[model samples]
Target: MSQRVIAPKSRGFLFLDSHPGGCRRLVEEMWRAVPDPAPAGGEGPVALVIGSSAGYGLAATIAGLARVGIRGIGVCFEKAPGRRTGTAGWYRTAATARLAREHGRDMVFLNGDAFGDAVKEQVAGLLTERFGGKLDFLVYSVAAPRRTDPETGTVHSSVLRPIGSPHTTKTLVFDEHGAPEVKEITTAPAEGDDIEQTVAVMGGADWERWVTFLDGRSLLAEGFTTAALSYIGSPLTAAIYRQGTIGAAKSHLEATARTLDERLAKTLGGRAVTSVNAAAVTQSSTAIPGIALYAGLLRGVLGDAMVAPVGQLTQLWDRLTGARPLDPDDEGRVRLDTWELDPAVRKAVAERWSGATSGTVAELADLDWFGDEVRRLYGFSVPGIDYGAAVETDVPWPSAGA
Candidate 1:
């Protein structure tokens, strides 16, 4: 990695590398100096959050702790530590721990594979030893390609291909020029095992592990609620997500919710809800083969209708905590993306896609927003940053598949 800290490229072309995830650490710390609220007349209920790192996890963590004032433990299943120019979740976790400890707020951070048995046991112990053997709420939001079972010792790897007939499409990918242009591609349908494996990884196995563990230890509370996050990718991403191995996992995941709900309801009147958030470019979203084009279209076509995710997080946080309160639907997913299927938004973006003539992924992706999101994902989107400033030291670079 280069020692020189280039004042991070911002705006226009080079936006994918915007580094928004890095902001998590800073946001956590800033919440600290504000003083803690009293528990009796205090802020909100205490909670434990899994996947409280970058993307949705980080936002959910911040919104609960900061915006809605719910002090809690964040269980992040990723590698590394400390907040820096890179490693969005690591930095964010470090910052949250600091604030939480200072306020006498109980918070524990576990950086490991969520699928492992040891991980499951460690979390169970945390609940038993710390939070009085009761968790008022649980949020399971994990997106990973692989999982290892604790007992059966089975491993699952996900796939991404549509079912039915073999499908082929064109994708815009990066080249030596640091620009993206469309190219032809072919994708095959997933085999039966492929679907099962995908379900094992993306499905509700891990979710069931946590909930069952809680129930076994008798740590579950009455009227307790849990939710799993899911995405149904568009027609464009069907080959890589919906129709692919991952979709199979999601199907399993959707089913897991029902099973989990059945188990939980037998005890504390618990229910497992599913929240299907609209598509936005998180780290996971950006890596897909053809969705960049869909994201690009989302950008150009949505206009001001586009919801900057941080803003959306604020709303989501409120809904989740009942801070301000909300009205529920049949399945219990707060419909944030209710308007996503709106005829106007999709129709406009479709027209833009038809007229697209550029080799740049930015144009197809609502480049300005996409690029901004890329930056914000890493915590580099603060307003009034002096572009000319230089750092005197080198720092660890963010690693995706590192």
Candidate 2:
């Protein structure tokens, strides 16, 4: 048996079984949010979700299994059980697989580096053997720090920096005591191949590669549809978000959507789209500079309108496979962030941002609520969980046949 230990702060809870109940609650919430099928016996679309361990990917998988009764294949890279602990995503994946089994749905989870060609080959083989070489939908929602180029054998790391010049912004940082503090930070502009590396690590190259491999081997079903998730923030954070290095990468991703759409139409009469999601407190989003403050302010403004990962993915499912046909914005992409960027909402957020300061941050924005949500991402601070209880660190992953 492995022993469990807890981290004081920064990374939040570290005990393996600190909050299984929290994870279960999230799973149940996702299931409850899934819309019922139409009168004509809804379309049960089989899906392959890349990076489907947590956040939007996990929510999409849950919605598919619970509402549509769709068979799913989820490929994600997560920390395996070790001597001390495993990642929150590790436990979440296990819980998701178990919930699918309870619903009489087959949810096959592949735990490995999704950027490698070998993982793609293994997914193709799994589909051939178990799913009859047919996948109706493919969802790409990967967020990684680094990527190793399959063709060049070079490693690329992504950076979040402004594009044009040095920009000063208010960001959240942990103090020596692990408490969150607001600080003014200035980031230099991206230069000397930074954009290329960021694009390479975070862009649509890997997504296109997966589609090409699947299409070539006839693994995709006829009329199959695919979607890659993206984020476009308001003008306030445009310098650091939408118009920054990550923004460049997103541009490439959206461009790849068009290319894949053309290829799918020409080949199997399929379609490819990009879904722009709203801002939320996700594992990856919390790490980005200036995003936390923005999220805190946005949460304060949006309040009830703010949609979490599960809500966003549920909406995506409805738009994709509901009674009505799919619709896209002028840029040929699904607009799921409309509410977040609503004129009134943006105006309120902007006003809050202008008056925000370290002294008044707590009262001006929902920083406490934001912090609680962040802890919830790691299975901590959830209601009904005893934090002092001893926990088993060696919980078995359902996908691993435990």
Candidate 3:
């Protein structure tokens, strides 16, 4: 790390460094919450998780198989998060899949873009051949910044900028420090097609397409389910979140969920659920223009319990396993991290931000654990991982790049 990178921000605190141990601890804790697998060795209770290599996407798949007794396949466009990798998420997934098999549970990994018709066909084929062409659940957790239309080949990139007027925001560059310095960001409003493409990529277009393709192939069973994850945050994030290109896509996702919910309910006796999970530092969030600034600030202010990544995944697990849940009304906008965003927690974070002073960033120093956790996510700080070991880049990096 460079000196300036290590140096304090205006608030005078070193950039929170990586801690592999802490991240492992968090993952272990999350795993414990997941009830143990009931019986994954059955014929094949399948789940197809689109973004099943990293972040909560991967976590969700683990909870399903490891806790809820589902034998499944994970589809990921698996380039290591934060940095590009030669092999995608499926590369690492292959090894994990092998482990699942040893325990008499089957896990297949298919790597490629789901935005293409060919890729969708391949997934359906995998299901047909590998596990009776049938699945019980499907989870869509794709986090791509760009998608190329298979027919047109026009690559559409998504952005999180204001719709009408120019907006300035604060953001922290990765490996750079505590406080987010002011940075100006602007994005053009979504044109009709932009909205369509965003919907095609981030929203429920691909999700529904996957379901339709599977349903046509007779690959989805009764009591089946399909879930799409979306985010609708606070008013503070309104400009970049609700009004940005991504949000336009999310609008389509939310709407599509309702349509798909009804279709699945009628066709497969299934349901469509869209979870608006709470935020934490992840490859997707780190690149979302100004989100890093908010994350860095939020980390310093909130308690560890408020970092809801694992808790959110467990909630999805619990729902999938037929556990009783606090009822959510019709908006379909159920908050997975309600516990984190409780009135008192939010109030305390606001109060902390209100009281902080420059050159005395004690709070950020304390919150360094989350930053440490972020680094470990890339396999940077595993217990016995040897950084000096000659990494075989020709093959997968075993861990995503830190």
lDDT tens per residue, model 1, 191-266: 7788788778888888888888777888777767777777774655666787677776776777787777777788
Clash number for each model: 28, 0, 2
Candidate closest to the true structure, highest lDDT: 2
Write one digit per residue (lDDT tens) for candidate 3, span 289-325: 6565456556665656564565677677677656746
Which runs in model 2 stand beyond 4 Å of their true positions? 3-8, 11-21, 35-43, 174-180, 400-402
Which candidate ranks first by TM-score, i.e. highest? 2
Q: Please report, in order, the local distance difference test score of every candidate based on alpha carbons.
A: 0.63, 0.79, 0.63
TM-score of 2: 0.93
lDDT for 297 in candidate 1 is 79
lDDT of 2: 0.79
- Candidate ranking under lDDT, highest first, comes to 2, 1, 3
TM-score of 1: 0.81
- Tens digit of per-residue lDDT, candidate 2, span 1-402: 764445424443223333444555666666767667322223356799998877788877877676667775899998766754567777778788877776667778998899999999889988888777799899999988899999989999989899989989888665556555678889999988889999998899999999999888988888888999999988888898889999999999999999999989888888899999988888888777788888999988878778877777777777777544579876769988999889999999889888777677777788778877788776777677666665666767665342
